[model samples]
Structure formats: structure tokens, C-alpha cells
Target: MDVVVIGQIARDLAVRVDEVPGPGAAVAVRERIEVLGGKGANQAVALAQLGCRPALVGVVGDDRHADEVLARAVADGIDTRAVVRCPGTRTGLIIDVVDGGGRWRYLQDLPEAVLLTAADVAAAAPAFTTADAVVVQLQQPLPAVCAAADRGRRAGATVVLDGAPPDPGARSDLLARCDVLRADDSEAGLWADAEIGSALDALRVARELRARGPRMVVLGAGSEGNVVVWPDGEAVIPLGDADVVDTTGGGDAFTAGIVAALHEGPEAAARYGSAAAVLTVSHTGGRPNLSREEVAHRARP
Candidate 1:
């Protein structure tokens, strides 16, 4: 399972409080966690935990935080040889503030220089060439995302796209090259140009997205869970029975799970994804902890 992940990498600081403060009032911080995180980093970490050899492709700064996060990526069993460190730029940072009821707020320090350029994606061509799957985060510049996807498709690898293309004009091109498309509620709404108010609505949008190009489509339907559609079947998938502790990292874990189990049918993949998301949201911050046996038992497909 050789995979290439193209997206953001950042230093994460997670603070947990029973409740958010208002005005200038102060409250006690129940816990603080600092780790390697970001959409790309979290997905790669989840893949590694699921026994895939993942190579991270994203930009960072030549700062101490970059070094620390890179070391952490290596320790988590991810290949960091393709990570770019831009000179004179500050490493990206994300502050995740989670409340007692599994809600989270984020403060991000991601700058333009920390984002990948098309040239950066081109430079990591070797990784794409050898990948069995290439997972792309669409929040990056369209040029970079297209470049990575094109490289993967040309190399005969499964190209999985995460999130909707921020550029409406670029959707067709990106979808045409993608094998799978996965998006959360807001992102799914972005694709549909309206809120997905129900599972049936999500299913309709998923089918439309699949018609555009993705062989499989997974769209979030708020609390109703995820809607999955493929060539031969479709279903409204629900989350596992794990109590939600913090919703952070759940989407990334879901994407990783699907990518990891996509060798099975799409239904099995959706169940695995749902199970992984359940496990991730049960903890804080955007890092994943997964177990195959646990996921298999928890999945409902």
C-alpha cells in the first residue's frame, strides 16, 4: 500500500475547556495538546496507522516547528522525503479549541508561502509515479491540486480527491481525473451550491458528482451521517456507536479509511470510513488512532 498525500502540514496546539469564554472573561484550560497535524498530515498518519506506507507531499517552513513535525511524521511511519521546506517562511500552525460537548474551533496560521505550488507538486513526481493511490486535498491552489492529480492519473494510480474544488470552473477538470471524491457537510454544500438538508439530497448530489467523473462519491449529510454512491449501488451510511468527544480529524480519518480499504467494494469502504471517523472523533485534535479489528467490528456494512 504505497500512497502519496498532497495537502497541508502544520503544528497543532489543542486546548480543551469545558466551555468557551465570552468577552474578556478567563477560564481554566482543562488540557493542552501539541502535535503534528493538518489535513494532509492527519490523513497520512491515519494511513500509516492502518498499515499503508504513506509519503507526505506538502510545504512547510525551515523553522524548528517544521523539524519537529517532520520528526513526528517519521515516527508515525510516514515517509517525509517529499515534504518541502520553504526558506524564510514560518511553519504553519493550527490552534484547535475543543469544548466538552465535542465541538471545536480553529485558529490557523497558514500563510501563502506554506501552501504548495504547482512546481512543488512537480518536484515530487517520483512519489506519484510509484503510488498505488494519491490522496489530494482540494483546499490547496487549483494548479497544484490539478498537477498532483494529473501526475497520479498519468502514473496509473488511484486518485482520491478530498473536499470540493474551491474554484467552480476547475471542478470538471479535477473530477475528470479523480477516482473517488469525499467531502464533509460544508464542502458537500459547496459542491451542490446549497445545503444538503437530508440524506436523499446528499444521495442526489453524490450521483451527480459521480456522473461528473468520480467512480465513487461520499458526501456528508450533517447528523444523518454520510451518503455513499457508486456505479453499482448506493447507501446512506451512519456513524459507528462511539460517543463523540471531539469532531476534529474525523473527516481525515474517514478519507484515510476509505483509501485503505478501497480494494474492497465501495460499501465496505464506506463502512470502514465511518468506523474510522467514529474512532477519531472520540478523541481530541486532528490526529488519528485506529485499529483494524476494532474498525471491522464497529463498521455496519
Candidate 2:
């Protein structure tokens, strides 16, 4: 299946720290590295790695970093033709701090990414029109995302939203435009009036979120598994056993997996997402070394 991913494309600087420093406390960095990351880029890469043709539509600066990011995406078999190069702006950057226990915190500067406008989405109409599904990461401008969703719907393609809408008031409208909505615990809490700690709580939130507009709602509850609520019914898909490494892009990977497997029912797609996430958290960086064969192998009992 062909998928179009629209969101931020960032150059990530990752550092290993003993711990997150307390207020004004100094902490030594154990290691430092750079990688291609961003919710949109990660999901696009994951989709390509899973044997799907993915076209990325986003903005980056006219700089060496932009060249590197696009180069990597192309090397990974992603179609970067829709990615725009904005002159006089620096590429988006993200600083990821990973602690000893594998927890991570992010500091991002997404100036150019957030500047993506409706015109940019319109320019990529061909990609959206031909896609089987359009995956939008809510990191970009809300208007741009909404525009892409409208185009996808008009083209009779599935509209998948990977994150929560920035404006709470627009939540219902955004959800209504999406065929599938995937949100983390925090985002789900914002949309639903519930604290998602247990599977039952997640199910409650998923049901509530589904009512907002999406035909299917998937709520990720870390190790507790994912709660999927569809018009027909609901189910809880458990995560697989894997050595935890870094969870920087686990959610994005899960979103990609689900989007790629959407031809199946929501329950089966959730299982595919669970398998993809299991492989993601076992590696470092937001874009891990993943393959469709490995994910399918891991999914098997």
C-alpha cells in the first residue's frame, strides 16, 4: 500500500545522561549522537521499512542538515519528492536526553516544521490523491494537517492521525476527519475524561475518543498494551517481550504499523502495531533498524 506522511522532519541530537538533572544541577553526558528523527519522519521510515511505499511531505531548511535528512529518507526507500526546502530557515532540531533506565526527554526547535502552511499541503496534492492512506502527525500547523486530511478523504483514502490536535477545541472536528486515531496516554487523557492507567481505563478512554469522530481509536498505555475501540467492538492488544532500549519513536512506529496493516481489522492492526513497537523499543534512536520480515517474525507465537 502507498502512504503519505505529513509532519515535521528533524535532525535529532541524542545524549546519554546518568539522570535528568535537578533544577540547575549539572549532569555529565556519557555519549552523544545524531540521527534522523521527528514524528513524521520516523513513521514514514517505519512504513518504508515495513515494505510499503511511503511519500513524505514536510518542510526542512535549505541547509546541510536538510540534505542529510532527505538523503537518509531516500536511502531508506521513502519518496522525499514532496518534502519542501524552505530557504533562510534552519532545519528542525531535537535534543533527546536518555537516562540510565532508558527514559527519554526531548527539547525541540521546530520553527520551520511548524511553519508548514496549507499551501504546502496543497502543493503535495498529487501524493495525497494517490495514497492509499494519509498519515498526519499533528506536529505541523493544524490548518495544514486538516487540509491534508480533507484531501485524503476526498480522494477516498483512509485518513490516519498520529497525534492529538494542538487545539483542544478542534479535537472533535479533527477526529471526525480521521478514519483511525492513535494517541499516547497523555493525549488520550486530553481527549477523554479519564486517567488512563489500566487497560480498563484505556478502553474507556478509547470508547469516548471513538465517539468524538474516528471510526477506530487506539490508545497506547506503555507496557500495559494498547486499547482499540472500533464501531463493532473493542479489544486490548498486549505488547511483546523484548529487551527495553529506548522508546523515543515507539508510538510513531506503532502508528506506522497500524496504518500499513489497516486492510485488516483494527484488532489485527493493533497486534501488528504491538509487534512493531516491541522491535522499536529494543533499539536506540527514534528511527531504529527495522524490517518487515523481522516484525512479522517477532509477531508470530
Candidate 3:
């Protein structure tokens, strides 16, 4: 399948340490991994690994880091033909620090130039037109997100939205253009306007969201898992059992999984998403190491 992922593209540096050092203190970094990252790139990478031909549409700085990341994306079987490189802008960077407790802190250096603009989306029209599914990261500017969704809809593609709209004013219009919506914990709470402490609370909120526009709404309900609501039914799929090492890119992978397996139905989407989350959290960094073989093998009994 041809999938288009609209989001960020940047460098990622992940460090694993026993504990975060105190102010001015020193601690040995147990492991260090640097790879291609950003929510959009992560999802595109996961989609590519799941047997989809993914085209990534995002911005990067015209710097050495940009070259490295684009090269890596190409090596990973992602089409970077739509990736923009802005001159005089430094490439985005994210430093993920994980402690033994499984908590993570990120030092991010993403500037405005790394963000997508409406013109960029317009320029990538050909990519959107060829896509069977289009996944948009709502963290981008309102114009860009809206443009991407509208283009996908015009092309008769399955438009999936991740995160919340950039602005409340455009939320309704944007949501109306998408077929599926995936919201993380913070975004879900924002949609609920309150803490979603239980799966039922998430289901109620998801049901409300499903009415807004999207045919399916999935909300993260903290430790309980993900709640999915569709036109005919709803389901609360709990997190899978796994040794979680870090949760930096769990949601990204879950979104990819859902979009990848959506043809099977909502139940399959939820199961695949939960399985992808488990696999992602079992790793050390936000860069997902996913494959259709491993995911299906691990998800099944």
C-alpha cells in the first residue's frame, strides 16, 4: 500500500542511564543510540517496515544532520521526495534520556523552519494523490494540517489524524476531513477537558469525538490502555504484556499499526496498535524497530 506521512523529520539521540544525575553531578551513560526520528518519520518508518511504501512529507534543515537523516530514511525504504530542506535552518534534534525507572526526558531543538507550512503540503500534492492512506501529525501549523487532510480527502484516501489540531478554531473542520483520529494521553485529556482516569471515561470521550467527524476515534487512557469508538461499537484494548524499556515512540508506532491494519476492521486496528505499542516500549529509543513478521508473530498466541 502507498502511505503518506506528514510530520517532523529530525535526528534522535537516545541515552540510557541508571538514573538522572543531580545538578552538576556526573553519571555514566550506559548506552547511546542515534538514529532517524520525529513523530512523522517514526510512523513512516514503522509503516515501511509493515510492508507499506511510505512517503514522508516534512521539513529538515539544510545541514549535515539533515543529510544524515534523509539518507537514513531512504535506506529504511521511505520515500523522501517530498521532504523539504530549508536553508539557513539547523536540522531538528531530540535527545531522549531514559532512566532505569522507565521514565524519559527529552531535550528537543526543533525550530519553526522545521515545521510544515501550507505551501509545503501543496507542493507535495503528487505524493498525497498517490497515497492510499494519509496520516497527518496535528502538531504542525493549522494551515498545513488542514491542507494535508483536505488533499487526502480530495484524493479519496483514508485520512488519519494523530494528536490534536493546532488550533481550536480549526478543529471542527480538520476533524471533519479525517477518517480516523488518534490522540495521546495529553491530547485525549484536552479533548475530554478532564483527566481520563479509566477506560470508560475514554470510551465516552471517544464516542463524543466520533460524532465530531472521524468515523473512528482512539484515545489513550493512561495505564488502562487505548479506548476505541466507532459508529457501531466501542472497545477498550488494554496494553499488552511486555518489558517496557522506554515509551518515547510508543504512540507513533501504535498510530502506524492502526493505519496499516485498518482494512481488517476496528478490532484488528486496536489489537495491532496495542501490539505495536508493546513492541515499541520494549525498546530503548523512539526509533521503532518494527517488522510485519515480528509484530504478527508476537501479537498472536
| Backbone clashes under 3 angstroms, per model | 0, 0, 0
Candidate 3 versus truth, CA RMSD in Å, comes to 1.1
Q: Estimate each model's TM-score.
A: 0.98, 0.93, 0.98
| Regions more than 4 Å wrong, model 2 | 20-31, 112-114
State which candidate, 1 or 2, has the greater TM-score. 1
Ranking by lDDT: 1, 3, 2
Per-residue lDDT tens digits for candidate 1, residues 243-277, read: 78788899999999999999988988988999999
Question: 39-115, model 2: which lDDT tens digit per residue?
Answer: 88899889988888999998999989999989988998899998989988899999988998999988989884446
- Give the TM-score comparing model 3 with the true structure, all chains together: 0.98
Please report the candidate that would top lDDT against the real structure.
1
Better of 2 and 3 by TM-score: 3
Worst 10 residues of 2 by lDDT: 292-301
Q: Write the residue-wise lDDT of candidate 3 on 160-235 in tens digits.
A: 9999767877767877899999998789887667888888888888988889899999999888988889999888
Residue pairs with backbone atoms closer than 3 Å in model 3 (clashes) = none
